[model samples]
Target chain A: MKQLRHFFDLVARTLFVLSSTPFRMKEFSRQLYFVANGSLPIVLFCVGFAAIVTILEASFHMKLVIQNDSMVPGFAALLILRELGPVVTALLLTSRVGAGFTAEVGLMKTTEQIDALRMLGIDPVQYLVVPRLIATIVGTFLLALLASMTCLLGAMFVTDIHLGYSPAMFLSSMRVFVDFQDLLLAGLKGAVFGAVIPLVSCHFGFLCEEGAEGVGKATTQSVVVSSVSIIVLDFILSYVFSYV
Target chain B: MIEYRGLVKRFGAKTILNGLNLRIEEGEIVFVLGTSGTGKSVLLKNTVGLFRPDAGEIWIQGREVSKLSEHDYLEVRKVCGMVFQHPALFDSMTVYENVAFGLRRFEELSESEIADRVKESLARVHLKGIEDKKPPQISYGMQKRVSLARTVALNPRILLFDEPTTGLDPVTTRAVNHLIFELSRKMKTTSIVVSHDMECALEIADRIVLLDKGSIVTQGTPSEIKKSEIPLVRGFLEEVLA
Candidate 1:
């Protein structure tokens, strides 16, 4: 019951902060840089490899069942857009950006910087959580799009070299199989994962106990909780969005 | 003005403050002196609504602060500032930005005016210049001074100092004490300083309230506290002054 109450409280606060615009644009921009730009290389690398592995595995099975590789692009498109793109990106961000937010906020709490902000008549939520939340939501959405594109490119490369399918054939197959709804669902999932990462991270960070050990624990919990939340949310969202 | 009536605070099975009552008049400097873990810092935090009492009433400026909501408490907090023991300045920001933080948040001033106020506050703490340096780049004493400047920049009606001179050398401790004295006298702001430093309490406090095991052992003028008959107060003063 207490956890449910806290979850709802965090949701309400996040909405309130999102609507109240123009409070701290500078901080928001800085956080965007940290979240999006700082994680670009890793996102690129991970999505590329995930795309290669998925295509290779799918083609291997297709050869056994149908003795053809023409269906590989469609299969890859379905997996990447609906599942791998957003979930993989979210997991990466949960480890990188989410852990960073938790550790930073935990340090500030231990050092009494958050208390100092309250003493100065500044709302710590407005000054700290809002910017980070906004950045995570927007950054994760964009990174998911980037990941999807990178995966397609990687799948094209793999099919061209190993499966005797040209890059044009792969592109044509993806265009035929992947629709606007798939892309929309992927984007929506990205935004949900984005919101969950910061919410879980900041919640643990704010509730962190004192001392260095507390910070370490909070960081670990943030990553673990965020990853689990992303996976669980992915399942739920996929189930719900499937009907549409 | 501040008033605490029958305040009670506990952590788990251990009580930190018990039925503590005290009154601080406006423009007066009161020092809370006690050994470590006697709830000296806890008492100061309670006054600012940082730590709410389990059962009690705290009145500040004729308002029942304990009943104020989070939003309402922010209004009350604006009239008060707290200088922490370790100088909790934002590590990422420069000295000027730290002092200007409160002013920028609460007040609408031109850039030049903000700069002037930041400069003035720093000067009041004898920290003129070095505004571009970050907190980590400065010495510990200077960091504390920057923290003081940050709080004073808001021009709060009441100031709370929590063990402000705890971990400083004698020279820096004396400087911090002197700065507190000058700020209280010059600004006519009601000040409550929590510390275990006898010399600091004796030097700047108009009245000293000594705490022993979650209760006030004695409360009197500095001269009267010097002549206190309580064994805890006497022993603490002897140990600190010795």
Candidate 2:
């Protein structure tokens, strides 16, 4: 519970600094490049496989239960846009980007660079967290949009070959189950999940103890907490999106 | 001038700083000498509002600063610059960029003016022609000097050093100690150094303060501290005496 309060405090402080401080475009661009471009191929490759799995599994289950795989495309598209694209991408990011943020910031703290920053009259929140926060939010949103497109295409391709459905047939059926709004909601989920990553990462970082073991523990805790936060936040967002 | 009045800092049940009180005059170099975990660094941090005291007040230039907001603390930090135990140079930036970071933030200097000041600051620390080198690319001693250069660029009224010579070799240690003395004496800044090196403390400090178990054990000029009979003081002095 104390940890939760500390997390919220970090969020509050980061937001306050974000609003009041001038934006650092150079650092923001650097972080965005790392978040989006650096992780792009891995995110796309993994999500593509997830899409194939979703298509195949949905076909098999529907055929056994209902004796027809006719709705597989629509169901697969619905699942991809609403959850798989954003959540899978985010969990991947939580491991890749979130862990990186934790280790980087944790090292800074252990090395006293954070104190050095404060001594220079530059707030660490303003110098480190703010740029990464902005970059991650923007990058994750874009990645979600791209991941959704890639997953839908992969699912379509799988339905045409494995499920014995044509591409046109898959698209026609998918239109009935999901729409553009699902994609936007998925992007929103990505943005929120992105915001959680740096906050959790940097919070553990600022509170990091000394030594390699301390940094190792902080990194593990940061990853665990961020991944869990993304899942919990996903459920909340999904529940809210259900109405929309 | 800076003063700490009955300062207390606790982490959970462990009190790191207990009723610690000290006064530092303007344009004086004070060495806070203590063993590990003795709250020497904590006192320095609390002075700048990096760590707030659980009880008591900190006054900088007659302004009560322990309660200042982080934004308000910038004014205090502008007057008090700290060099950490580590080099603490930003890994992502070159030495030139690191030194100019503070100038770009607090001063409205043009790019050329900032570059000139950065060069001058680095030169003050006896570093020249390493401007484009990143922290990792340079030697550790050089990195430490660059960190000092970064802090010195701001021309702060008070300078704080946290074990500035901990990991260096004897030659580099003497060089850094001399650099600290030179910077303080030449700049005429009030300097507080947290260190465990009694030998260096005696050489550079105008006043040496010995701390044990989070409180002052003895504080005096070099001759007075050298004459003290306290066991802890004797223990610290054994190496210097040898």
- In terms of lDDT, the best-performing candidate is 2
Compared with the real two-chain complex, what DockQ does model 2 have? 0.80
Clashes of 1: 0
Q: Which parts of model 2 are misplaced by more than 4 Å?
A: none
Judge candidate 2 at residue A9 and give its lDDT. 86
Candidate 1 chain A: 10-residue stretch with minimal lDDT: A14-23
Q: For candidate 2, give the lDDT of residue A25.
A: 96
Best by DockQ: 2
Residue-wise lDDT of candidate 1 within B123-208, one digit each (tens)?
99998868999999999999999999999998999999999987899999999999999998999999999988887788779999
Worst 10 residues of 1 chain B by lDDT: B233-242
| Residue A70 accuracy (lDDT) in model 2 | 95
lDDT of 1 by residue, A95-213 (tens): 99999999988888888898898887766777788898889999999999899889888988998998988988987888888889889989999899999998899888887888889
* Candidate 1 global CA lDDT score: 0.89
Per-prediction RMSD in angstroms? 2.2, 1.6
DockQ of each: 0.68, 0.80
